[model samples]
Target: MIESILPSYVVSEDLFEDPPDTMLFPEEEKAVEVAVDKRRREFTTARLCARRAMARLGLPPVPVVPGPRGEPGWPSGIVGSMTHCTGYRAAVLGRSARVATIGIDAEPNEVLTQGVLEVISLPAERERLRELARRSEGVCWERLLFSAKESVYKAWFPLTGLWLDFEEADLSIGPDDGTFSARLLVPGPVVDGSEVTAFSGRWLVRDGLILTAIVLPAPATTAGSPPGASPGSELIGS
Candidate 1:
């Protein structure tokens, strides 16, 4: 479902259940060695999803460890992101040469816990979400907007290697096109001598899940080739 919005170079895969220990790579097992059973399971399952995505790209599965800030440290020639939630786990991978960056997020299709919408959303964003809720039936626009910001931050951090607060970005959602745009209130990331102050992405509400994804092409006029290495925000399993 997430693939529909991405470019052809990106490969995404999703899993609906927790696989057994047999799905883990040796190095991956070591990375989650200290975690309790639950964390370990979630981490391993996400990695497995990543490996399957890599396979679709014709690349072998490599241990996707945690970087300095707990972001996924993808394999040498891959740019990717991972996310997981109850009953769902997913990963999106793209060849570093063809895709600049990728960000995908999954959230349960439910309202945010009390106070979280205010904590993570701007006053304007909250007001817009309220209006969206009145128009869309059976959708939690608050959580959907939260997921959009999460996707924006996930993409922003890797490009800038800087932190993006939840309230720092403003979002506008389109009901008809399944697309949203984010304007960076702070100075944006510089890529290939150009500054990116805004981001655009696609979203969907499906099967009790809210999914949002962003994909940036190679900085130059070509298909394959990205800039220097960077890290992104750490996700809480999902």
Candidate 2:
């Protein structure tokens, strides 16, 4: 489901069930050493998926340890993101030379947990959600909004190495297009010499899951010109 929404240059792996054979790297195991069984299972499985993605990129399996903010640390020259929720776990990777950053998230297709929408959403976003809900009762737009912001932060953190609060991004979701765009309310990151003022991503609701993804291509280069002369490639699934 995730691959359908990403570009060919990206490698994506998602697991519906924690593979019984999933094992963590020695270094990775220490991150969750004292966690409950559930935490260990998801942490281990997400890394397992990440390693599988690395192998697809023609790289060897390595420990996918978390950074200070819990962002998965990727191998040099690789940019990626991972997410796990309920029965879903996923990892997406791209070469740093071809892709600037990637962010993804998965959530059960249901209403937001009580009080979550208020904390994460801007007032404008909440009004839009109501309109979307009225238009299509099938999708949990509130939950989708939360997932989109999570993707925004996942992508934002890697570039800026700073925190992006939930209320920092104002989202505009398309009720029919399976897409959304995030307008960064604060100063955006500068990627490959260009300032990223906003982000556009794709979303999907299928079976019992809602998935969202954002991929920013690395800037194109030329012999005489500086980077960011043109986007490395068109944004995926735009």
Candidate 3:
């Protein structure tokens, strides 16, 4: 499902499993020893998926530890993201030379928990979701919106190293096109030496899963050059 939106050079991998108790690297194994069995499985599986993606890029399959904020600590020169929900796990990766940073998320197609929507959405976002739900009968617009926000934050945090409030991004979702645009409500973060005020991403609802992805390109070597002229790549799903 994710292969369509990503650029050809990016790698997107997925697994649905009760992951085995694979021995993790020292740091990662120690960190997860305290987690419940289920949490441990999810975390281990996500890391395994990440390692495989990186290995495909001709990089070593090293241990992916957690950063200070619990984001995956990828190998040097790799920019990537990971996400997992019940029965679903995925990881996306691109060489830092091809993509500056990337974020991907997957969620079961379902409604947000009661009152959760009210907390995460802006007034305008809620209104937009209603219009979208009216137009697209099958999608859970609330959940799609939430997933988009999660993708946005995933892409945002690596660059900013700061928290983005749920209401901080104003999203305009086009259900018909499976695309979305998020305009930063706060001063946007500086990425690769440029201030990014907005982000464009793609989303799809398929086989009971809602997936979304966002990629930030490395700044162009020259102002007018094309995306791939820089050192990085972006992800898209089929």
Q: Which stretches in model 1 have alpha-carbon errors above 4 Å? A: 221-238
User: Cα-based RMSD of the predictions, in order?
Assistant: 5.2, 4.0, 3.5
Model 1 worst lDDT window (10 residues): 228-237
| Model 2: lDDT to the true structure | 0.84
The reply for model 2, stretches above 4 Å from the true place, is: 221-238
Tens digits of lDDT, candidate 3, 133-175: 7777888989989888898888888778898999898988877
Question: Which residue pairs collide in model 2, if any?
Answer: none
TM-score of each: 0.89, 0.93, 0.90
Better lDDT candidate (1, 3): 3
Candidate 3 global TM-score:
0.90
**Candidate 1 local lDDT, 1-238, one digit each (tens):** 6766565657888888887754676777787789998888788888888988989988877788887667888878788888887778889988777666678889999988998988898889878887887887877888889888888888887777888998889988877777787888998877667777777777888999998887766554242322321112111113
Most lDDT-accurate candidate:
2
Question: Highest TM-score: which candidate?
Answer: 2
lDDT of 1: 0.77
Better lDDT candidate (1, 2): 2
